[model samples]
Target: MPFIAPWTGENVPSPAAMATRLGRAGYGIGYADEYGIADRVRGALWVRVPVKPGAGGPLLGRIHALRQRQAMTHMLCQGCGQPTVGGRADQRHLFLTASATGRPVAEGEKTVSPPSCAGCALEAVQEGLPSGRRYVAVLVEHAVVWGVAGIVYSPHTLAPVLRDVGNEFTLVAYDDPRLPWTLACREVVALHGCTAVDLRDLSERTPA
Candidate 1:
């Protein structure tokens, strides 16, 4: 199973679970039973979800918050949940992402998608691209935890800010003031020293 896949047993948490919690940073959203460091990422509050893997079939395109965070924090492959860099401490990790312009992955690009191992990179490139869009692969020398993608709550009203009609998530950096009021769903990382890889060559080494 994919590391970030959401199982059927993992239901979405209701908005009623959120309440205003005042701290040194000011008013932020928190659960009634929220723990200090455990419930936060980089001082930003994260959404809580139950851990139940293999409860049912994989829910494609949906993410389980905790699993996503785990894969990202440990640099595990989104495909097989194994170490993406393996034991090569000096080797760069591989990251794949969709590109509308068909350009190569660039340095300092922030992405919510975690790194993929060589075996899964080929599968992703073969099956993950949308109609007309291309996918790009890059070997990243550094993948730094930058921020998160989550719901931003109002500091005053303590309600979620519906920025647009359908946009429920917003990217907020660690240093951004709005982070304090946000409930993170996925961890975002910035890729540095990226070198684009050709999928044709990558497929050659993929296991049969």
Candidate 2:
């Protein structure tokens, strides 16, 4: 894909329009003491013109820009931006990328994308990606926060900064330094106690 999962034709506030705005006003998130988790958790924010992102634009738009945290914890659907809590507690909801085959979801594994609803998962498997990257649905009871995906800026200057050593374009983590301000783009979390399920299995079931 051209756009990320949430940025697909489904989500609102066109990426082209947002990109156009960013181009005109310059693309860079501001430094803040803390970022709102709910904003990034849901794909309800996007960039606006003159770089004056709306209420949730600054952080949420950055998240959307990188296509990172399209979904949040507790089986939040990456496709339709809804809670996919599933019918039973043990059997929640899940949607996996092809790379998730052998890899084990450890206690602190980082997840860029979020879970998908049964309907969206099926839609993806049917005609989501042009390359046909296989995605799997799963049942999970819980998850935990890991970190975030955003640019680190200098609080004094409010300019996006990067690791001094490695790639000049690299960003720092949330717990790095106070000077290197962190603007969270993605709310990463680790999936716990998951049980893989087929899309057909969820056909008769969905999150409430």
Question: Whose TM-score is greatest here?
Answer: 1
User: RMSDs, each prediction?
Assistant: 2.6, 9.7
- Write down the lDDT of every candidate, Cα atoms only: 0.83, 0.45
C-alpha lDDT (0 to 100) for residue 9 of candidate 1: 82
- The global Cα lDDT (0 to 1) of model 2 is 0.45
**Backbone clash numbers for all candidates listed:** 0, 0
Query: Candidate 2: where is the Cα deviation over 4 Å?
Result: 1-75, 89-91, 98-107, 154-180, 198-208
TM-score of each: 0.90, 0.51
**lDDT of residue 109 for candidate 2:** 52
